[model samples]
Target chain A: MTGVLTVVGLGPGDARWLTPAASEALASATDLVGYGPYVDRVPGTPGQGRHSSDNRVEVDRARFALDLAARGARVAVVSGGDPGVFAMAAAVFEAVENGDPAWRNLDIRVEPGITAMLAAAARVGAPLGGDFCVMSLSDNLKPWEVVEARLRAAVAADFVVALYNPISSARPWQLGAAFKIVSEIRAPDTPVILARAVGRPDERIRTEPLSQVEAASADMSTIVIIGASTTRLIGRAEGEAPYVYTPRFYGVRP
Target chain B: MTGVLTVVGLGPGDARWLTPAASEALASATDLVGYGPYVDRVPGTPGQGRHSSDNRVEVDRARFALDLAARGARVAVVSGGDPGVFAMAAAVFEAVENGDPAWRNLDIRVEPGITAMLAAAARVGAPLGGDFCVMSLSDNLKPWEVVEARLRAAVAADFVVALYNPISSARPWQLGAAFKIVSEIRAPDTPVILARAVGRPDERIRTEPLSQVEAASADMSTIVIIGASTTRLIGRAEGEAPYVYTPRFYGVRP
Candidate 1:
C-alpha cells in the first residue's frame, strides 16, 4: 500500500495564522513528525502518532517520515513558518533525492504557510512592500563567508533584506555582523526592524534607524528587516509605534 | 469615536489559503475597500459595505478606506496576497503619510496571507528553498531601466528570483527582456518555472530549462521563478513532475 507524505507549515506561532489547507493536512495525517516544539503546536488528533525530534535533525526527521510513508503509514511533517522556506520542505526534498528511489513515487505534497518574515513584516507595517530578499543568517549548514557574501550582495543591490535565524547560542555575533555590513552601505537614517515572536503572545515589533538599532535585542525568534534606501517610516501619535513601509515606486534621481 | 483600519490579504485566489487572522479581520470589519477583484474575494457579510475601485488607483482606494475609518467605520482594505508585500499595506501607509494627519492616529493593522510566490513555490517543490529575491516586472510606476538594473543585480547575486506581474497587456516585453538578462548570468540548464493562478481553478505549474522556456506563455497572473545556481532537481517516476529545491547547504566550493 503506497501512502502519502504531506509537509505543512504551522505559520509563526499562532493557530489563528494557520491556513485551512495546513489545518486540513494536519487533521488527515495518521502520524506527525517534526521538531518537538513545532509538532507540539498541532493539537493531538485521535489515533495519530507523533514523532518529535531535535531541531538539528532535519534530514533525519524527513527520512524517518519518508520511511513511514513507504511502509503505508500516512505521515505529515510539520515546520514552523512556511515549510518551503528554510524549513521541512527542502529537507523532505533532499531526503527524496538521496534516499531509497521508491520513496519518489509515494505521493508527497507541501502546503505553504505564513512565513515569519511576512507575519513580522505585517505587524510592523510593510517593510517588505517592494523588492526584497529573505536570507537565513545561520552559518551552520553553509560557510560564514557565503552568508556574508549573500548579505553584502543583497544589501548592495538595494533589496530590502529580511534575515531569519539571525542569532543562536552557537552563532551569536552574526546579527551584529549583519547590521554592521548593512549600516556601511546604507545611510545612518535607514530603518532597521526587530520583530520578535510575531503572531505569538510575546510579539514585539519595533523600528529604529540604522544608527540606533541594537543587535543584542534579537534572539532566535527574531526576524530582522533592513530596509532599502527608499524605505520610509510614517509618524504616529505620541506613545504609538510608527508604521514603516518601502514605497512601490523606485525614484532614480541623478 | 476612533475606528480601526485593517489591511488584510485573501491569499492567492483560494479561500483555503486565507489565514484565520485575515478572516477574523474581515469578519470584524464594517466596511471593505480594495481593488474590485480582490474586494469580491471576501464573502459578503450581511451589513458590511464594500467599496471596490480600479487596481490602478491604490492610493485613492487607501485614502477612501482611511476616510471611512476616520468616520468611525471599521474598514478592511483587502489585497490578493499578503497585504504587506507589494499590496494594500504600502498603499495605505502611503496615503496616511500624504493624506490627513489624523489618519496616522487611527488603529491600522495588517494581517498576513500566503503570497503568490510562496504558494507557487510550494506547488512545485521548494524552489525558493534558500536565499531568494522577489521583484515585480511591471514598469508602470518604476522606470524600465530600474527594473532591468534590479533584475541584473538579483541574478548576479545568485538569489533565486521570483518574478511577479511578469506580463501585463501593456507591459508585454519586460518578461522576455528579464529572461534574456537572467540567461546571460545563469546556466542554460537552470530551471525556470511558470506558475499561473497557483491556488485558483486555472492553476498550472510547469518547469523548464532556462534555454527553452517561452516568455509568451506567461500572463499577468503568472509568477516566474528562476532557480539559483545551487537549485537541484530530484528524479521522479516517469510521467510525474520533478521536485525542485535549493539545498540548505551552500557549497561555495573553493
Candidate 2:
C-alpha cells in the first residue's frame, strides 16, 4: 500500500479563512495528526484516526504521523497558519530521517496555508512589504543568545521584525529582553507592532515606539515586536485603526 | 451626506483568495476605484460607479475616491494585495492633505488583505521565518545609490531578503545589478529565490545561488533576490526542485 503525508495550514481561526485547497486535503486524509488545539480547529468527520497532544509532544507526534504513513495510511498533519513557520512540517521531515528505513519509500509533501505573520501583516498595513523578518521571543526551545543575535542582526539590517510566541505564562519577560536587545541595535523611534490573538476574536493590533511597548499587556498567545526600513505612521483617527507600512524603496508607497 | 472611504485589499488575483471582510467591504461600496486590472477582477455590479485607469493614474483614482466620500457616498478603493503595501491608501491620505479642508471630516479606513510576499513565502518553505528583509530593484523612482546602500546594510546585518519588482520590460537588467551589489557584501554561496507571478495560475518558484540567478528567467512581473543569515540549501536533487530555508533558530533542528 502506498502511504503519503500532506501538511496543511489552517489560517488565523475563522472557518472562512480556511482555503479550499487546504480543506480538501484534510477531508481526504485517512488519518490526522497535530497539536491538540490545531487538530480541534479542523472541522470534518472524526472517523479518521486522530492523534493529538500538547505542544510539548512534537517529536512524539512526528513519530505517530510517520508510523501511520509507514503502515499505508494517508496522513494529514495540520498546523495553525502555515505549517513551515515555526510549525510541525520540519518535525515530520526530521522524523522521516530518524525513522526506520521502510518509511523512506513513503511520499511526503508540504502544502502551503495562510500563516499568522501574513495574517497579522494584513490586519495591519504592509509592515512586512519591504524588508522584514519573523522571530519568536519564546526561550522555551532555544537559548536567548541565538534569539538575541538574530534580533541584533534584524535591527542592523533594518528588516521589519515580526515576533512570534512573544509572552506566555511562564515566559513573561522574554519579549522585554528581546526588545531591549533590538533597542540597543535600532533606534528607539523604530515602530513596534503588537498583534494579539491574531485571527481570533478579540484580536488587537497596535504600533508604538520600541521604547514604549509595555509587557504588562503582552501574553504568550500574542505576537509582537518592531518594524524597520520604510515603516511610517500616518494620522488616522479612532474607529479607523491605523496600520503602519513600509513603502517599497522603489518610491511606491503601497 | 456622510461620505466614507474604506480601502480594501484583494489578495493575489484568485477570487477564492478574497477574504470575507474584503468582499463585504466591496459589496457595500457605492463607488469602486482602483488600477484598471484590479477593478476588472471583481464581479460586475449594476448601479455601482467604477473608476479604473493605468498605473500612472493612481493619484487620480485617490482623488476620485475622496471626492465620492466628500459627497457622502460609500466608496471602496481596492488595491491588489494590501493597499498599504505600495498601494493607494497613502495616496488617498496625501490627497486629502492637499485637497479642500471640507473633505477632512469624512471617515476613512484601511482594511487589510494578504500580501504577495507572504503568499510567496508560504509557497516555498521557511526561508522567511528568520530575520528577512524585502527591497524593490526599481530605480525609476529612487536612485541606484540608495538601493545599493540598503543592500550593503542588509548584507552587513545578515538579513534574508525578498526582492520585489526586480525587472521590467524596459529595465531588463535591474535584478542583475541588485545581484551584483549584494554579491559584493554576501558570500556567493548564499541562496536566492525567484517567485514569479505568485498565486496566479502560472506561478513559478525556483531557488538558486546569487551567482547563477542573473541567467535565471524573469520579467517585470517577477519578485527575486537573495536570502542571508541562516538561509541554507535544505536539499538538492537532480531533476527535482531545490529547497532553501532559514532554520527555525528557536530550536535544534528536530
Candidate 3:
C-alpha cells in the first residue's frame, strides 16, 4: 500500500465554512491526527485511527504523523483554520526537512480552508479590505521585540493588522503591550475589532476605538483586528452593530 | 418585502474549494451580480437574475446589487476569492456608506472563502507559515510609491510577502520595478513563487531564486509570493518539486 499524507484545515467553528476538498480528504483518510480539539471535530470513522495530542507538542505530533504515513498509513493532519497559516502544514514540512529521508518521498499535500482572520473579518464588515499584515502575538517561538517591531512597521505602512493568539492563560500582558504600541503610532479613534469564537454558535464581534478597547477582552479564541486610518464605521438607526470597513481607495476619504 | 444583500467568494478557480456557506448564499440569491468571468462561474438557476459587468466597474456593480436588494431582491455579489481580500465585500460596504441611507438597514453579510494566497501557498508548501504581509502591486487605487515603500518595509521586517495583482496587461512595468526593489534588500538565493491561474485547469506554479525570476512571467491571474529570509526548501529524491516551508521558529534554524 502506498501511503499518502494530507494536511487539511477545518476552517473556523462552522462546518458550513469547511471546503468540499477538505471534506473529501477527511472521508478518505485512514488516520486522523491533530490537537485534541481539532481531531475531536472530525466525525469518527469505522476503521480510521485517531491520534490526538497536546497543543504544545506540535513537533512531536508531526513526527508521529510522518511515521505513520511512512508505515503505509493514509494520514490526514488537521488544523482549525487554513493549514498554511500558523498551522500543521509548516510543522509537517519541518518534520519532513529534519526527519528520515524517506519522509520527503511521501505524497504530501496541503488543502486550504477559510482562515480565522478571513472568517472574523467577514463576521464584522471587511476591515481587511485593503493591504494587511498578519502576526501572532504569542512570544513562544519568537521574542516580543520582533512582534512589537512588526506592529510598528505595519502601523507606519498603514496596513490593517490582524494579531493572532492575542492572549492566553500563560501570557496575559502581551495584548496590553501590543495595544500600547499601536496607540502610539495610530489615531486614538482608529477602529479595533475583537472577534471571539468566529463562525461558532456563540460568536461575538465587537468594534470600538483604540482608546476605548480593553485588553481583557481578548482570549486564545479571539482575533484582534486593528484598522488603518482609512477604516471607517457606518452607523445604523438604533440598537444595531455598525458596519466597519476600510475603503478600497487610498489617501482620500469618502 | 424586506431586502437582503450578501457578498460571497467563489474561492480560487476550483468549485470544490467553495465553502458551503458561500454556496448557500449563491443558491438563496434572487439576483447574482459580479464581474463577467466570476458571474459565468455560477450555474444558472431558474427565476434568478444574473448581472455580469466589466471588470473595472466594482462601484457600479456594487450599487446595482444594492439597488436590487433594496427593491426586495435577495442579492449576492460574488468575487473570485474571499470577499474581504481585495474583493467585493469592501466595494459593497463602500457603496452602502456613500449611497442611500435605507441601504444601511438592509441585512448585509459577508461569507468568506479560501483566498488566492492561501490557495497558492497550499499548491506549493507553507511558504507563508510565518509572519506575512499581503499587498496589491497595482497602482490604480494607490500610488506606485506606496507599493514600493510597503515592499521595502516588509522586506526589512523579514516578512513573507504575498503580492496580489502583481502584473496586468494595462501596466507591465510594475512587477519588474517591484522585483528590483526586493532584489536590492533580499538575498540572491531567496525564493519567489509565481502562481498563475491557480486551481484552474491551466494552473502553473514556478519557484525560482529572486535573481532568476523574470518580470514578464506574471500576468493578471498571477499571485507572486516572496519568501521570508527564514524560509527554506527541502530537497526531494529526484525529478520532483522541492518542498518549501518556513519553520515555526524564528531567529534560529531548525
Evaluated at residue B52, the lDDT of candidate 2 is 86
Mind sharing the TM-score for model 1? 0.98
* lDDT by residue for model 1 (B1-254), tens: 48999999899998999999889999989999989898888896999998999878889899999999999999999999888877889889888998998888999999999999999999889999988989988888788887888778888878899998899889888888999999899999899999999888999889999999988989988999999999988878789889999988788522
Residue-wise C-alpha lDDT for candidate 2, range A1-254, written one tens digit per residue? 48988877786776666666677779989988998888888875768878788886776787888888888999999888777667766566556555775655566666665667666666655566554566667666667776677677667656677788887778877777887787787777778777777878888878778778787667766777477755665545556655466654435543
lDDT value, residue A93 of candidate 1:
90
The candidate that achieves the highest lDDT relative to the unseen native structure: 3
Query: Measured against the native two-chain assembly using Cα atoms, what DockQ does each of the candidate structures obtain, in the order listed?
Result: 0.69, 0.30, 0.79
The TM-score values for the models, in the order shown, are 0.98, 0.84, 0.98
Give the Å error, residue B211, model 2. Answer: 2.9
Candidate 1: clashing pairs of residues: none
lDDT of 3 by residue, A1-254 (tens): 27899999999999999999999999899999999999998986899999999997888898999999999999999998999998899999998998999999999999999999999999888999999999989889888888888888988998999998999999999999999999998999999999999988889889989999998998999999999989999999799899999988787443
The best-first sequence of candidates by TM-score reads: 3, 1, 2
> What is the lDDT, from 0 to 100, of the residue A122 in candidate 1?
87
Give the proportion of true interface contacts each model preserves, from 0 to 1.
0.85, 0.24, 0.88
The prediction achieving the highest TM-score against the true structure is 3
Docking class of 2: acceptable
For model 3, how does the per-residue alpha-carbon lDDT over B125-191 read when each residue is reduced to its tens digit? 9999999999999888887788888888888888899999998888899999989999998999999
- Give model 1's docking category: medium
As for candidate 3, its clashing pairs are none
- Measured with DockQ on alpha carbons, how good is candidate 3? 0.79
- After best superposition, candidate 1 residue B76: deviation in angstroms? 0.8
lDDT tens digits, residues B1-254, model 2?
49988888787766656767678889889889888888898785788888887885666778888888988899999988766655676566666655766656677777666566666665655566555556666676567776676667666666677776677777777677777878888877788877787778888888777777763487755666477655765453356554455655445753
- Measured with C-alpha atoms, the lDDT of residue B212 in candidate 1 is 95
